[model samples]
Target: MKTTGTVPRLTARGVATRARIVEAAADLVFERGVAETGLDAVLAASGTSKSQLYHYFADKDDLVLAVIERQTERVLAEQEPQLHELDSIAGLHRWRDALVGLQRHGGCVGGCPIGSLVAELAGSDRPRELLRAGFARWESFLVAGLTTMRDRDELRPDADPRDLATAVMTALQGGLLLTATTRSTRPLELGLDMAIAHVEAHRLSRSVQPRGRREGPVDAGPARPAGTSTASRSG
Candidate 1:
C-alpha cells in the first residue's frame, strides 16, 4: 500500500472523483486500448469535466501512469497470495489453471496491462521505466515464492530462483500476447503447460516423471528425475 515519492492528499469528494476516473480509465483502456482511448472518452466515461480531469492528472501521460499503477496494484493483490502458496507442485498447477481460466473465459480480449503498456511505450524511456519497475515488483514476488520452494526442498538447490521466476513471468506475458493476437486461448494454455513442465522436470527428483494432467495435485514422487539446471534469461 505504501508508495514512494510525494503522496497526494485530497478531500473525500476529491478521492471519490479520482477513484471514479481511474476505474473508468482502466476499463476503457482494457476495452479500447491506450492509443485509441483519449482523455475526452475517459472524462465522458467517468462523468467528469475537463477541469476535474486536469485536477487529478496533469495530462494524458500522468493519467496513463496512474492507471498503470492501479493495474499493478490489482495484479499484485490478486496473485501475491497465490504465488506465496506455491510450496508444492499441486499449488503451482492450481495457479496455472486459474490463470488459464481467466484468459479462456475472457476470450483473451485484452492482454496484460503492463505488457500492453510496455509495447505501447517501447520507444519511450519514461513509460518503459515505469513498466520495468512494475514487472520487477511482480518478478520479485515470484522469486520470493521460488526461494521458499527451494528452502522446502520442492525445487532443486541448484536452481536460480530469481532467473526461473523471471522466466516464468516472461513466458506468461509472451503467451498472453500471443493469445491476444490470435484471439485464441490455446497459446496461453500451451505456454503455461510448458512452463509448469519445465519447473516440474527441473525439480529435485531422480526419475523422469511426466507432468501431471490434473489441475491441483502434486504427483512428483520421490524418484522423479531432475531436468536441466541452466537459468533462462529474461526478455
Candidate 2:
C-alpha cells in the first residue's frame, strides 16, 4: 500500500530494507504459496523485525500487494525485448520461440509468476485487481506492437490490436499453466504458434502486400528443442 509515489521518499537504506522485505515475501510465497506464507515466515526470511515490516506494509495483504507489484515489474522487464518485436509475423514467431525456449530452459517448473498469483489471489478483490492490472499492462505491450503492424497495413484494417493482443495474452497464460503442469514446453509452443498464425491470417493479400514486406507464408522457424533462461523465474 505504501507505493513510492504515495509515501514520503525513503533514504537509500530504508528503500533497500523495504525491498528486502518484499523480495523475501515474494520468494516465500512462490515456494509455499500465498495461504501458507505467513508474516512470521516473511519476517524470518527477510531478517527484519515486525516493526520493520509493519513500518512499510500495513498488513499481510499489503505486503502481498508489494510482492505482486515487484513480480509484475520483473515479468515485464524480462519480456520487454520480445514484446517490442511483435510488429510482424516473423517478429511474432521469434517472440514466441523465445517464450517457449525460456520454459524449456526452466524445465517448466514454475507457471508465469503473475499468472500463478491469479489462482491464489482471485478471491481477494484488491489482489485480484492488482493481478488484472498486471496482465493488462502486459497486454498493452502486445497491443502497441500489433497496432504498429496494423498501421503499416500488414494486418487487415478490421484487425483490432486490443482483441488480437488479448487472444495472444490469454493463449500465453493458458499455455504457461499447461506447460508448468505437464513439465513440457509443447503447450506453450503450440499456443504461441496458433496465436501467431491467427495474426498471420489477417495479413494483406500477396497482390496488395507492400513492396518491402516479406512474401510467402510465415516460416515457423527451424525445428529445435526449446531453451531459454530469460524468464526462468517467471514460471
Candidate 3:
C-alpha cells in the first residue's frame, strides 16, 4: 500500500481516519461495486467529507488499490492454518471446507472481492500489476506447500509442484466464477473436490515410506468425480 513518491506523513489520527475511509469504501464497493459506488458514497459512509477522502486516496483508483489489498488479506486470512499447512491432504480439505462455509455464510454474494474488481477494471493498466501481485502471492503459498509435499516424498518424486499448485487454483477460480454466475456453492464444492483429488492422486506409495492419505488429510468415500452430483431438475 505504500506508494513510491513524496507524500506528507500523516499524524496518528490522520492514519486512523484514512483507514476509516478505506474500510467504508471497501464495504461499499463490495456491496455495490467499484463502478456504481462513488466517492460521495464513501464519504457519507465513512463520515468524512470530500477533502478527507481525497487526503487519503488520490482518486477512486487509489482507493480501489487499497480495497484490493484489504480483500487479499481477507481472503488469505479465511484459509487459516490449512493455508499454512497445505502440504497435507487434510489441510487441503480443511481449506476447501472453509471456503464452502464462507460461501454459504455470505450467501455466495460476491464471487471474490479482488476477482470481481478485476472483471470490472481489467482494461485499466494502473491496478493490473497490483492485482497480479495479489494473485501471485496466493499462488506462491500453494506452490511452497506443494513443494514441501514433494520434497518430503509425500507427493510422487516426479510430480511438478508448480503445475499442480496452479491447477488447484484453476479449479478454485473456476468454482468461484461459477458460484458467482449461478449463486450456488455447488460449483465451488465440485471444483475443490476435483482439485483436492488431483493433488491426492500424486501421493507417493507407502512402500517408499512415503506419507499417504491415511497419514495426512483423508476425505471420506471416493471423490465425487467432477460434474457428478445428485441434484436433478424437476419438470
lDDT string, candidate 3, 71-160, tens digits: 788778877567898877777777787787777678778887777777787788877777778788888888998898888877888989
Off by over 4 Å in 2: 1-9, 207-235
Tens digits of per-residue lDDT for model 2 on 27-143? 888767888988898899889999999888778888888899989988888777887877777678778877877767767877798898888898989899889999999999889
Candidate 2 weakest lDDT stretch, 10 residues: 224-233
lDDT of 2: 0.80
Candidate 3 is scored at a TM of 0.87
TM-score versus the correct structure, for each prediction: 0.82, 0.86, 0.87
Off by over 4 Å in 3: 207-235
Which of 2 and 3 is ahead in TM-score? 3
For this target, which candidate reaches the highest lDDT against the unseen true structure? 2
RMSD of each: 7.3, 4.1, 3.8
**What does candidate 3 score in Cα RMSD to the true structure?**
3.8
Clashing residue pairs for model 1: 205-224, 206-224, 207-223, 207-224, 207-225
